[model samples]
Target chain A: MSERAAAGIRIERVVKIFGDVGITALNEVSLDIAPGEFVSILGPSGCGKSTLLRCVAGLDTPSKGQIVVGGVPVSAPPEHLGIVFQRDALLEWRSVIDNLLLPIEFRGGDSRAVRPHAKALLRMVGLEGFEDRYPSQLSGGMRQRVAICRALVDDPMLLLMDEPFGALDALTRDQLNIELQRLWLANRKTVLFVTHSITEAIFLADRVVVFSPRPGSIADVIHVDLPRPRKLAVRTSELFHGYAGRIRTLFEGMGLLKEDE
Target chain B: MNRQSLQGVAITTMTLIVFGLIWEAGVSYFGVKPIVLPPPSAILRELFSELPWYLGHAWFTLIVTLGGFALAVVIGVALAVLIVESKLLEKTIYTVIVGLNSVPKVAIAPLFVIWMGTGAEPKLAIAFLIAVFAIVIDTVLGLKSVPADILDLGRALRGSRSMMLWRIRFPCALPSLFAGMKVAISLALVGAIVGEFVSSQRGLGYVILSAQGTFDTARVFAAVFLLAILGMLLFAAIVRIERWALPWHASQKDYSPSA
Candidate 1:
């Protein structure tokens, strides 16, 4: 591990307008994420939570605002950061171990030196025996695990994930949630996870930043005081339901979730 | 080979033998004139007697086809990359290639003979011109087919444009490139024969043409048989290369998606 301090993020009034017709995806969205915080941006589909994540990753630039990461403004994908998409994005030609080593290779590090770290990460994800397996050989859940290992192989300070479990089955999603929490507890890297799952956001995040529907802006921020090393059973607790109920009510206000007559 | 592939080979060989027997019986039963359509037995006899002579002409055709195919791969891949990388090249170069492909390559075979003379050069040139189009089109398709999320992942990782192309796009394009090559190799053989037809002193095409002029129907059948074998071998060679280079794709083919 790098032993470097985790990075904080500051999204200062970021406004993103797409194309000539001026579709405003993010409308003056701003948030402050402390170092080592696990923050999830939760909202409905077409909500600019993903847009916010993209701005922080430097994959897209905000038209009217700036994003500061690790004490410096993000220009072109700031150093010591990693991202995972909904799809595993593992190079089909590469084996699982090689896929894990991709970020190191991209950063001009010697892959030979990082091989041990990559192996350790795979072991951490319960994929030790699958080091030589191709992505196509693995199930959907296993591929996503490889992708998460790939992102963490470089020991990034800030990790951004965009709906990383959206495609997974419910059982796999629950399992990955537990694994992700364990991993997060171990490294505690600053994570800005984007998702539409209310329970998932509250279960995984230190704070859930809810966004309104399209032309997305922060609707509310709910802090989860649930203890560390949270198990799946914790999701059924009264306190967990309190946080979920608050988020549900917020979504109901935004016309995202409705109570049937 | 595995048991499955061995069984496949056995079945293919059995089918070919049945086809040969049918042709032999039909020719003899119909009492076809030797000058019109010789029996498969007669063609086979000619092939065995002139084995060394037929081998030399077949070798010439093979060399010209392979040479042209190699040239097409190099230039075609380079051009496809340029077309993908630059909007200007896509607009100008790709448009020109598509336009040039529409003109019949056989119609222009004689032009290559006129320009490069009655040597291997014209045959190779014709083969290249005929084969290049498939390479460019399939490669372009493959390069563009990379998933959007994968590109976004590359961008998030700060991959340089050249690095992304080399590490991601090019490898992703391999299966499609192999598909193009398989088609091109067969087309290259056809182009080589056309070039030889235009003007050549050697190759299977020359042997066929001279035999046709002399009314040596058996010799023509033998040369055509050799050409068919050559084309099949070249195509099989490409399929083998595809399997070797794309182990992931081959293994994935056997994978049941329900898993």
Candidate 2:
């Protein structure tokens, strides 16, 4: 972990319940992420990993618990944090460049100043020639790239991704994972990613936090001592397998891992 | 213009001419009196001969149609926004609007004339009543139909309520609003003509009523033709505006059948 002073995210006893039913989505979940660290909250479907991310992003308030980001309590989404959703969620009417500039527009930033930065971010995300194209004209992977650029346009201190590449094909997802790692390295923004892929979590995260299903709670938090600038080749490495195996064991212990696979 | 569009225009003009010729031939062959069923050519001649007199009537009808259409758009959009913003109001007011919309607007035109007045006001009111409910229902559905993930994205971006409305909700609702506008435009035309038929000194509706009373079939045909043209023009205008405003919409793109 980087020796950054501030805590990126601090969650304490977070509990979320839908309606009057005491059936919990999240039960006494707590986690702490260091500044500039890339952490993945890994779990199967209905594990409330997404709910945890939403609570941290302040999109949904926890029924009971506290979440602090960058030394400030996150009751509502703050200007300094950026979020990338599973679907691109890009405005179909807007051009790729305009979509990238959306966060800046929301924050009341100088449009003229942000335009250049937005352009640069789009280029960085490998969408250089697609600036003027509308979202409908772009392929699914390209649209997601535009969304990533939009999230990073404001140069936010923290980035929250809820399965940002979950909908993409395996090839596209792998490519984006590499792109994302490069982005995280260059920006050094604190990132909390939610995903179901064990290999993905092992490949991308400094720490992989696993959760149990239903009334989801942290099953385990395993540190990945894998070296930086991870490439696709790293996936076949023994180190990658070791980390993936540990995560699988954790899921197996929670009765989440399928016996067949 | 493309070859297909040019060909389409040629075919449309040819079809109209053929229809007109057939009608003229049928009337003349049957030796139909001008008082009963005059030829299409006779109606055309009468239309051109009394152009200035009909222009005034056309203007009056246009005013009522346009005025009512404007009112419907404003009230419909505003009410849709209100309904979408509040569930209790939506449930209560939506039922009332639906009930009112179901009642034949023509039956209420005379009542409107009594309440408002015969001069343009009642006509406009009738048109407004006819068109507004469609706008409200379609626009409300459009506003509400925005994807939940998009809304969540807005929330995540910390967008203000006003920002969300102006930037996201309004634009998202535009296609649906245009759909409502198209339906309302047709209804507005019918409403204006009906209002004039119920009580009016001028307009195509008045002309048709007078022609029927005097047994002048050619004049009645002319008036009906003009009204059809007016309805087509108004509907076409709305479609053109929709194309101009929402060029990014998927439906606007000319996709190959194979693609």
lDDT of 2 by residue, A1-261 (tens): 222332378999999998777779999999999988899999999999999998988888999989988889988886567789999899987888888888888889887887877887777778887888777887788888888888777888888899999999999899899999988887888899999999888889999998899889998999998888988998898988888888888888887767874
- Tell me which residue pairs clash in candidate 1: none
lDDT of 2 at B200: 87
* Model 1 spans > 4 angstroms off: B250-259
Q: What are the TM-scores, per candidate, against the unseen true structure?
A: 0.98, 0.93
DockQ of 2: 0.51
RMSD of 1: 1.4
**Cα RMSD (Å) between model 2 and the true structure?**
2.8
Best by DockQ: 1
Candidate 1 global TM-score? 0.98
Clashes of each: 0, 0
Q: Model 2, B164-190: lDDT tens per residue?
A: 988899899999999999999989988
The interface RMSD values of the models, given in order, are 2.2, 3.3
